[model samples]
Target: MSNGNNRQVIRAEIKYPILAIVVLAAIFAFTSFALGYDQGQLFSIVVGDRAYEENFLHELFHDTRHALGFPCH
Candidate 1:
């Protein structure tokens, strides 16, 4: 009877996932800051008093914004 299970979580497995999460979080934060509804004006363009698309970043990354659960119209 031998109970010698030498299974350990590899550093790469842990690190890579954490790294990816951190990178994604940073990107999401940046995008939110740059194009969120509250502050979208900084990265948006207005025309003729009223424009169809106010947020350029949202329009440019429409699909991604939706996928990331960011409101965009």
Candidate 2:
């Protein structure tokens, strides 16, 4: 790969995964405590924003998934 292509891939492999972890951690933590242990409520709150929530959900579900042994979009 050319230098620019290599750099782009490297950056994507690092940045999106990290962002996914942070977001997932925040999601878990908030669902665990900040929302009084109510997962459904938390889900509701998160989904309440409708458009914003759906977009976030898309980013979460598709682009930046869990930070595990997998690739994120």
Candidate 3:
């Protein structure tokens, strides 16, 4: 019936906004961690302990981290 169709439409519309919010939140968390907290631990899974020594992400985001007051050094 018409009511069922409307309910389906409402559910569909709600799903998209919820999905968008979840996706955006995930992106924000990832960016925040990468720029503010990452210090090679993420890359270490592939590169081994050398990543910790090299600190690739930390070096890459060095200036931004300092600007954001993350205290890299």
Candidate 4:
């Protein structure tokens, strides 16, 4: 019963790859742009130039943009 060697091994089960981090960062940046700086640009892709004139997104995020300190005017 007098053994001098006893050891325990530990392993981590979670892993984060560079690709996952990059994808998350991209999503965050896109969301920020949409909510803070979007002036109908995103909707313009589907609705054409009219989106800019309508300024739907701008109005939708207007109060939020101001609260978050984004220049809407």
Candidate 5:
């Protein structure tokens, strides 16, 4: 006589890929901003050959930029 209960479960493995995507996106965003690209200026930088006079992130986050001493002016 024997009584047994056995069950096997497998969980999907997707967290790693999702995390990688998020990290890459964050890096891209930070690099873009740090290099003076934000809002729609990324397009300009890619399409044109000259540096931009304004940064949309700086303009949009003017108060924050000044508070952080970013020297937007």
Candidate 6:
């Protein structure tokens, strides 16, 4: 009795061709640009959260307060 249960299975494979390379490269470049752009939006959202608290201009207020050595309550 021969059981072929234990065998190496290739989960994924890329075909070798000029068009394949071009298509993959285009996708990679597009994804890079899209991710970078989206990351900028994400950063702005996080910064905005930090920049506003208790009805204050939290970001600018921080700089001015620290520069003038004003007490932070």
Winner by lDDT:
4
Model 2: per-residue Cα lDDT over 22-56, one tens digit each: 99999898644422322233356545646444444
Q: Which of the predicted structures, 1 or 4, would earn the higher lDDT when compared with the native?
A: 4
Please give the RMSD of candidate 3 to the true structure: 8.4
How high is the CA lDDT of each candidate model?
Answer: 0.61, 0.48, 0.87, 0.92, 0.61, 0.53
Q: Which stretches of candidate 6 lie over 4 Å from their true place?
A: 1-15, 38-73
- How far residue 45's Cα lies from its native spot in candidate 1, in Å, is 8.9
TM-score of each: 0.35, 0.26, 0.72, 0.75, 0.34, 0.31
Stretches of candidate 1 exceeding 4 Å from the true structure: 1-28, 35-40, 44-54
Per residue, candidate 4 scores C-alpha lDDT tens digits across 6-51 of 7667997998999999999999999999999988899999999999
Tens-place lDDT per residue, model 6, 1-73, is 6598878878887669999889999999865443332323333455764333432333435555556665544
Clashing residue pairs, candidate 4?
A: none
* Candidate 5 deviant stretches above 4 angstroms: 1-40, 43-55
For residue 64, give model 3's deviation from the true position in Å: 0.7
The residue pairs found clashing in candidate 1 are: none
Question: lDDT per residue, candidate 3, 1-73, as tens digits?
Answer: 4656555334444345788889999999999998999988899999999999999899899999888899777
Evaluate model 2: give its TM-score: 0.26
lDDT of 5 by residue, 19-69 (tens): 888999999988747644354466566655332455454466667656766
* Number of the top-ranking candidate, with TM-score as the measure: 4
**Model 6 worst lDDT window (10 residues):** 34-43
